[model samples]
Target chain A: MDNPNLGGEPGSLSPGITVLIPAYNEAESISDTVNSLLAQTVQPAAIIVVDDCSTDGTAEVARAAGATVVRPPKNTGSKAGAQNFALPLVETVWTMAIDADTTLAFDAVEKLMVALDEKEVAAASGFVVPRYVRTVWERGRYVEYLFAFSFLKPVQDFFGKPLIASGCFSAYRTDALRALGGWSNRTMTEDIDLTWRFYFAGWQVRFVPDAVSYPIEPHDFKFMRKQLRRWSHGFVQNVRLHWRRVLAVPTLRMIVAVAAWDAMVASLALVVLLPLMIVLFSAPILMVAYVADLPVVLAPILLGAIRRRETARALASIPGFLVLRAVNAFFLLEAIWSELIVGRPLRLYEKGH
Target chain B: MGIPVITAISVIFYILMALTILPILRAVQAIRRSPRGAGRPHVFPLPVLAFLMLIGIVGGAWVVATLAVYRLAEVVPNVRGLLPADGAEFVLLGIGAVSMVGTLILVLSAVEVLSWFCAEREPKHARGPDGQKVRPTDLIQGGVHSGRPHG
Candidate 1:
């Protein structure tokens, strides 16, 4: 990889593009992720790998592979904390935050760059599609992501208030990033935190679906549970934290409020209420509720699968998504219970496999 | 309606109504919150309008089917005997129509989802106030940016 100390002038391809990869014990995947970034059509001015005080040779491997590796004196506790360690070192006008385990498309950076050109776009993120589809959890997430990115995100983008700028593969103007205090540690999901903050501050965030990034997701139930817990809690936490400011941003407030209501109520409707109604009342006709949203769910999954030419995979995964959705209700319910009802903060940063 | 039956009916009724209203409410909210004027909101874009139409048709079909079933029950000896009260026919319509509506919503929602496929994923840009270029840095300093983000 040629050292891309690239020139930063107007019209220059990625003139001041600096890529920041936040990692902890990512030795197995760090080098590959770094290589993919280096191989991008538009090379970044610098690639800084923040090892986050990993016990593994993650830092050594990254440095050996030619990335300017930075390991904080102590563990930053989360991916956001790790990314913040390298913020001061950023000299370029633009910064791309890439997760250590994720790899980007060749033209992903180029596509994201287009958003940065527009002054309103504070951060532009690529679509995240999982690299593996073998596990039930992975397949379920694939469907979830498909529905989210393919249908949900476009609407959010249309309103110009995409709920998130997506942390895994997103670009932000460096100066703008610092002003918001970089990746915040206030929430477990820093990407969501930063995205909402940007929106509240009157900055625009873009979702470029074509600029794809692949990150390996949890393949087993144990890891899936942890990931879901953090995510669910993080979502509710953000709502609690930002509801006031979110209201000020019209579309964002409504989208988030509705999403929160759905997360809380849908679980009750699907997991608890459905069974209780049938078991107690013995209303055989009420069974319709169980399959009522089938079209709504299946339509997006099948269409997404057909577009990717994975109709069979989508079909096979439909059942998996159903199971996952039920399980999601349980975990989400627990998160809401713990975070909101019990009033306990989930402080530990448990890495979801 | 019997006490338990009334509770069941009310539960089913409100849940269905909630299901139906949630998305529409969201769409309208999307428009209201949109930086663009009410002339067009992202939620009610052409495709979404078509989806709303299909749902409306489904709701309309349920009303007609319920009325038909109510009339049919009056003529059938066994069905008529099942309704012992003066308002029994109305109760029958409520039960019958809701179930039909549920089925219609299921089918149409599937159709609605099917219409959504892979998007072009292009970034659409709009200028801020005074036609001046507003950047993220500017927003940090409180730039005059609009609500519609790059679509």
Candidate 2:
């Protein structure tokens, strides 16, 4: 079949861009995702969705939407495994990774290409806005994502170390990705790991804020917790794997910020101590003491909320988002302690993805 | 010296040890049942394992020390009320902390096993007519479906 996006006869021109979607049991969303791709202004040379042995008719829906589907012999692993399945199939110079439940904006692909074409850019990751956020938890996540995408990522890019590339809409220069040995199959947050790997290899990644994709957020607390726990564990694992790079370049603002914040937040002593501070000290005294340390404690949260207005509103609902942050903090501490002190191999799937 | 102290110490130690052993036993059983070399057991590096063991030991010691303090308080009339009404709360907190740490270790070990298994059994490479790895782009053009289709 001739691809109109390549700007020539099918056989005459090489595939310039290939979009890969890693899917598993996404029957409800696959068709719309494929249709969105089909409706792209600058279409991909081809679309390949790697079905990770979904019992649902995800493969059939993808096929009907005009995407070529490939199912692995066995469920190889998780999202990373599915992407690895599609890596060998990409014949294009650039490959875009889009989640099955996400819909890309019409110009997302074109903008990604433009960003990748820039000098020294190894990969281009786009912004993800939550498509359906019905519950309070989902709304909170929507806010968190905005801060991550808009403020934090851009700041990280300026420092030359982007922490994560949203899996929903990320593009990679094939050569750079292949040289880095594709994606690590063992990690849950492969996109984050890959971003760090590219950074360590001295490859520059760009944040294309204009390139957008709408992804489904968890509608309830249970699903939200599962997602956050997986992400928290994955973040901890990646830190263990790349602590050397982080330590070597201690001057990077984002690195310093993450280390400082994570250390303070994850200290079990701090959580237990904070409540004690309230109990042992008078409320007035505690409030004064906290105010004295307000900048450090409240900076990330307030800045995070301001940058993501939707998230700010979501944070307002729970009165403090303390439970969310505390649970997330606990998991982060657990992950770090497990990997570093307990000599545990970071398990990505035990939390039941 | 008394039975109550010894009983408390033994019960606490046994519970801690069992918590540690359960996951390790499950992991070892999993490794043994898999076909030989089908999956490698996930093991923390020696240095890392040593560090974790040290933490576990220190944590275990803290539990013993707390129990010893409580026992001493019980035996000595002068220091009996020194710990205050929240004494039990502190003891519970200590146990809870140690249990959480132990649980984290178990989870880490489990993840290591699963990661090793997944890496070992990655899908076979799809080869082309030239014996080169088949590119997805090529397969799409060739229109030949190869691999077992899912039901």
Candidate 3:
């Protein structure tokens, strides 16, 4: 095969990393994303952009910025579909999925590649911090990522499983990805679907904190709703889909159980019970339960901020976090009701940001 | 508040923090010893210690309140007959019941989701990303082809 997408001969690329950017109408941000990959400490074998029939000249911009562009005959409808279109062309040993709106730290690829040195690791994901943190939604996600990546994720990793190797910037062994048939579109979040599948197959996925990627998060309520709805439904759908196989994986089972409990019970406590108590018991103090976990949440945020020297920025974002948490609780409850009770699952792949 | 009441609350706060944060410290030690984590600078940060303490305090308070309620119920003649004799045993029983219920829900949901998966069959003409029709074997074999709409 000519393998024109790659430089030199196919499979001859050293370090063996082929980057896949599944894009649709991402001309505005696609150049920066591709440029970031080009400037990596460990240059990728090829940066292939699967232009999912974007009318905005996304393919042109990416091609201009040194990426090999391929367009699908039709709009693939989801990121997974677009990636799958480009999967067969990956001649390198490792296949990485990077969101069109995300950029990586200069050494991000270098850091993440270390974990793939371990044969057991089928896929590895880096730490993700929002690229811009000015808007309320962005700020809220900034704090949320800091807390999750710093605290919960490490514990999960220590137990030999990190929940989901985040979708935005994760690398997988090409063989592993092909054997599993690429990312699945059956669930709202293909990344979670793929990660759980990896677990069931007895393959390991890793979380590399040193390797960091910055993804542009939803900056306003309009975009946040699209992102949160998909995420909430994705989570519930995965639990329903993988609950059987999950029972055999000890760490994963415990993680899912606690997550489900918290998602269902804690959301009820915050969204419904808290308001009901305040109204019926005439005890406004019960509202304190809404922000009771703030101190604990802040602990991880502060640590993550201190490492990045953004303590003040993190502290200023605390209010945003609280607001986002409340909003998250409501969406989770809605998703549970919609998927489990109403039997209506979200099937559209709307752009999150 | 009276000085005594303020002092008592402070004391309880510290106790809760201690109980919760202590286990985290132990976990950190184990992580530091692991081959992958040895000498990692941020293994045990102060915020984690502080956060765990806060969680401990909140969780401990809940446990304490539950035990207190049990004690209160025992003193009431009407409710006294309802709870088991030992307050500790009663709390354990409550915990076991909740766990059992949660487990049952998980198992039932798993069965439901699996049945749905089993019954789900793609239409004869559904084309996958590569322009090939998705097969039923692909579904059971983990991930060869996915025909559903993406989210």
Candidate 4:
């Protein structure tokens, strides 16, 4: 599996790899991200940061940190468009999609290449750890990453389809990516959408737990709520687009089954129950009734605790997390209703804080 | 018993629903018709539809309630008598009139929001190196600033 002609030698360097960072108003973190990439052991041939018309000096910071900055005409609606805008500019054989707010490990690129080479994989996604986990919301997201990276992704991979490849850190074989018409500009969850598309196009995606990238997690309630809302809307949008694909592909059966179960049972359950929980807490009698039903509810929590001790600790932030979840569910329900009944697309904007 | 009044209310409700539902239907159809793998439509029409539906249901209920009160006034002799001696019937009519107007405004606003949603644009074309219809990657020359030194 060696290509000596394309600067590839056995246990030697391969062709240049391009790290594309799509940034939108990430002035606070762009410099650090660039610096981290500069320090990488397997240095990227180019670091292209697509600044989507940031009003702030995000492009400047990226430039100062030694990334080649390309500014879009305006915010092109999403990160997908930004990548699409920069795809032609990338000359490297491999491209790594790195978020502007995320800092990659020094060995991240090397580790990804090892996985890609060994498995003959078309794409590989690395682990995303939260940069600051001091806050409750951040801690919850840390647990979420653990569940995703350690448990869920493995399960998804075993089923022959990975549900989501985080946009924070993912490497792709340039040819394979370009052949799929690049990322779809219309999708909010383009990362997840592209992963599925790549899989369907006969490309296997490997998960490299060692190739770590640290992304800033939402530290406050408002930010967390907005983040969750965007994620929920994106999830709905992705599901709507891929529902037919999952049905058409036999290999995707288990993955589709698990996703359906999660969407229907877990997502809907949280949405319905959160609102009810709020209402119940407002009433003394209903609160007492809920307390009596605690055993039924606590069983799942207890089981989760036994299975994943770290997750149990994270779940202690349940009150705040539930509030965020309820907010997200409200937006998700609205988005779903709009998509299913009204026949409209879902719009998720990161307009304000 | 007033046929004209009932007819007017029903017409308004239908009109409201039509104004609210038509654009959303159009947006949805557009999304369905668009190419596959393009991603979720911009959710342009749904939010508007949902908002309108909420207002229509709530406002319609309020209108119905007011109409019911008027009917009560007509049915119960004591209730009619308890009303203001002068122009009390007109006052009840005025309340219904205001409610109907309010409903119309609510429906109209919903339509406005829906229109805004539908107006959202899709991603524009990616330009090439020669200012032609090009792939997105052509914009990157010499692999994104090769001359720049690493930090």
Clashes of each: 5, 3, 1, 10
What's the TM-score of every candidate structure? 0.72, 0.61, 0.76, 0.59
- Candidate 4 wrong stretches, greater than 4 Å: A1-14, A118-120, A273-328, A351-353, B1-151
Candidate 1 A-chain TM-score: 0.93
Per-chain TM-score of candidate 3, chain B? 0.28
How many clashing residue pairs, candidate 3?
1
| CAPRI rating of model 3 | incorrect
lDDT, candidate 3, B1-151, per-residue tens: 3323433554466477656555664564456345653434444554456445644545444344444444666687665554433333323323433453455457546645645565535565556678877666565555545643433
Residues B7-118 of candidate 1 have per-residue lDDT tens digits of 3544454345445544644664455355422345545353355345335433333333333444666787665554434444334434543554454455444333433332
Question: For residues A23-106, could you state the per-residue lDDT of candidate 4 as single tens digits?
Answer: 888999999999998998999999999999998999888898899999877787787778878877777778899888889888
Question: Which residue pairs clash in candidate 3?
Answer: A349-B151
Per-model DockQ against the true two-chain complex: 0.05, 0.01, 0.05, 0.01
By summed lDDT, the worst window of 10 consecutive residues in model 2 chain A runs over A1-10
Docking verdict class for candidate 4:
incorrect
The model with the greater lDDT, 2 or 3, is 3
lDDT of 4 by residue, B2-118 (tens): 434643664475456546644644554455344433444564645456456434443344344444444767998766554433433333333433454464455445444544455
Two-way lDDT contest, 3 vs 4, winner: 3
Please report the TM-score between candidate 4 and the true structure: 0.59
